[model samples]
Every structure is written in structure tokens, then in C-alpha cells.
Target: MNLNGTAALVTGAGRRIGRVIALALAERGADIIVHCYQSRADAEETAGQVNRLGRRAMVLSADQRDWNAVESLCRQAWDTFGGIEVLVNSAAVYRRTPLGDIAESDWDEMLDTDLKGPFAFARFLGPRMKERGCGKIISISDTAARMIWPGYIPYCVAKAGVDAMTRGLARALAPEVQVNAIAAGTVLWPDGFDAHQQEQALGHVPLRRAGSPADIARAVCFLVEHGDYITGAVLPVDGGRHLEG
Candidate 1:
């Protein structure tokens, strides 16, 4: 993909999908600023992996829901890396907040973390990229945003807003920075699920299997490394489950 001189900022890079994407971008030759909130150990592990890929890596901690934190995160990333060439908004708060039982705090937190954080980061990063004349900003979305997930209503709504924000930024940042998203299906089984529960869930996937963090990581790399013409696109890495779901 020839990202030899580029720098990338990845949020929630402490573990899981975010960790994998951080490593993938490093492998593709982009220096990385990996962001994490509470998982300092895991964030260090991710940075170690990025360094192993022979790309420069730095770890930054910030709660994505906080505006000051989001602004500072981008500032620190730009300062550490000289500049950011890509921004991946992968930090998110996910939980089953059913419509009926969704508390004010729960709703606010989900919206702020999953939606507002990305918007704020993009707002800060977009102008800088405009000065450089080229950049990419990718956000992570969930299948729940496409189809109603009864108990996960709040998370779904927040992700939907993320989708809308991605498109808006694509238009606003046109001719310079590209904005896009990757909507995932039953990728990693959520933590605490038993083997039987995992199997039951896979039955619904057309591929008869769950995806790995690498699958999602690969999509991000494709967007950042190869999809220059593709803006405002929400590519689904959902194993065709979006069809049935």
C-alpha cells in the first residue's frame, strides 16, 4: 500500500479489534499513535507489536467521551508523529441498553463515547489534514446500526449517528481528506460468552463462523492504504450477515 511516510492515530488500541488495526497499519509502514483509556498494559502490548513491525509507535491515554481528552489526544498525536496521515475512530462503548431500561446516564455515555468522540476528533484532525491536502478518517460501526437489535438499542443508535457523521465529514472535507466507516457483524464474540453461546451465534452467520480482529483490521488497512477514491462509504465486513439480519 506504500504508506511508508504516513502516520496514523488509532483509538481504543489497547485490545481486540483496535489492537489488531494498530498493528496492521504499522505493518503497512505507517508510524502509529495508539490510544487507550484504561488498558495501559494492553496498550503497551499493542505498541510493542507496532514497534516489532519496525514502525514508530507511541501510546496515549484518553477517555474518548471527554472533549478536552479528544482534543489533547489529536494534539499529542500530531506532536509525537510530526503529523497524522490517518485517523481511525475505533474507541466505543458497547452494551445492551434496552430502550425501556435505558437510563439517562447510559444513553448519554453511549452517545458521547460512540458518536460524539469521533466527531470531536475528526473536527480537530480534519483541518490539519486539509493543510496537508490528503488524509483518511475511518470509523467503526456495528451491524446493529443497520438492523434493530432489541436489547442493544442505544449502542445501535449511537453507531447510526457515527455513520451519519462519517458521511457528513466526507462531504465537508472533500478534495482533501476522505471519511469512511467499516460496519462489522458478529466479529469477535463478546466477552463472557460460553462456547455453546458462540456456536449458537455463528449459526446465523452465512459463513458459519465468526470473524477475527484481523478481518476488521484488514478492512481498515484497505481503506487507509488503497481506497483514496472511496469517501463516505460504509463497507460491511459482516460475512454477509447483513443480508439476513
Candidate 2:
């Protein structure tokens, strides 16, 4: 689908990859609905950038894990732009939940924020897109879902859930809207990742380096602007890390 003049909803657009994706879509001539959980200031900044790019932009905040909040978020998105032609589920939390230190709350937060949150948005928005007869849904998944990185069991599980949800939604949304995932690997290292940890992470990457957010951003553009025949697929923008194992 052509991105020109359409509207895109990008979750977690306050910072990081989500921010990059938002700007990229704006550059493609799409207005942006920036969603943030607690980063309104940053989201506003992102919206300003979009405006500067000559595209309409707005900031909305919501708790992705809350059904009511998600429902309201969707309402505002449509009401503001008439309709959202693209939905990018980029809001997620990543944390280390080691085997022994893992707690119930850890599981809840990871699953709720990382897995259920994205699903809730897609579940609430996918049908509407289907009704419109055209749309694109892309979730930012992780290669860790395939590798099952140690010390991050919950994160891995949540990303695995994202992969599953992507496929399921693609089928559910059918020929109208394309649903897919981009499984990233080591694009942005988390805080507190020591040099040793970073080294270990890159050791598994055949490209021997981490990726930049632009890589993922470009892939998103391709799926949104050029992937008319693609759906239910997880495209890896991991610099070949997913191929290591």
C-alpha cells in the first residue's frame, strides 16, 4: 500500500526503534499517531519532528496491557485521522529474568507488557483495518525468541508470543491487511549490558556487529510501502544473527 497521505499508529514512539519507525513513516508521507506509556515528553518531541517533516502528527499515551485504554487509544486514533492505515506494535519491555530469580511479577510484567500489550492493540485494531479493506500491521519482535537467550527467559517467551500472534493475526486479518513481524537482534543493547555481555551477544552474529535502528526502519518501510503480497512472515533484520543458530 502507498504510505502517502495515510495515517500510522506507532506504539512506543517516544524513543528508540519506535521513534525511528514513526519518523520513517512520516518521511514516506504518512501522518503519525505516536503512542507512549510514560514518555509523553519524548513522544511530543517525536511528533514535532513529524510535523517538521510536513506530516501531521499527534501524541497519545496508554497502558497497552489495559483493554479499556487500548480501546480508547484506537478510538482517538481513528477520530483524529478518520482512519489509521498502518499499525506498528512496537511497545514492549525487555528485562532479565534469570531462572532462579524469576518471580510471578516478573512473568506478569514481561508477558503483559511485551506480549499481551501488542496483541491487545492488534486485536482491537486489526478488525477495523479489515473493515477498511486495507492496512499493515508490523510488530517488532526479537531474535531472542528463536535463540532463547539465557537470563532473559521471560523476554524470550514474550517475543515468541509476538511471533505467534503475528502469524495468527495475518490469517485472521486475511487479504485486506498484511500482518508481519521484524525479529531484531542486538540492534540496541540494554542498559547495564557490560562489555563482556555485549561481546558475547555479538559473538553469535555472523555480521560481527550490532545493527542500527535504520536497518529495521527501512524494512518496515518496505513492508508498508512495497510488501503488498507479504503477510504472516517474520523478516529478520538481525544482521544475520538469527542465522547463527
> What is the model-wide C-alpha lDDT for candidate 1?
0.89
Q: Which lDDT tens digits does candidate 2 get at residues 46-69?
A: 999999999999899999989899
Report the C-alpha lDDT of model 1 over 1-245, residue by residue, as the tens digit: 35898999999999988998998888889988989999999999999999888988899999888989889878988987888989999999887777777899998898999999889889999989978898999999987788868888778989999889989999999989999999998777677889998888777788888888899999998998889899999998988888886
Give all TM-scores, in the order shown. Answer: 0.96, 0.98
Pairs in steric clash, model 2 = none
- Candidate 2 local accuracy as lDDT? 0.93
- Best-performing candidate as measured by lDDT: 2
Backbone N/Cα/C clashes per model:
0, 0
lDDT of 1 at 223: 90
**Which sections of candidate 2 miss by over 4 Å?**
none
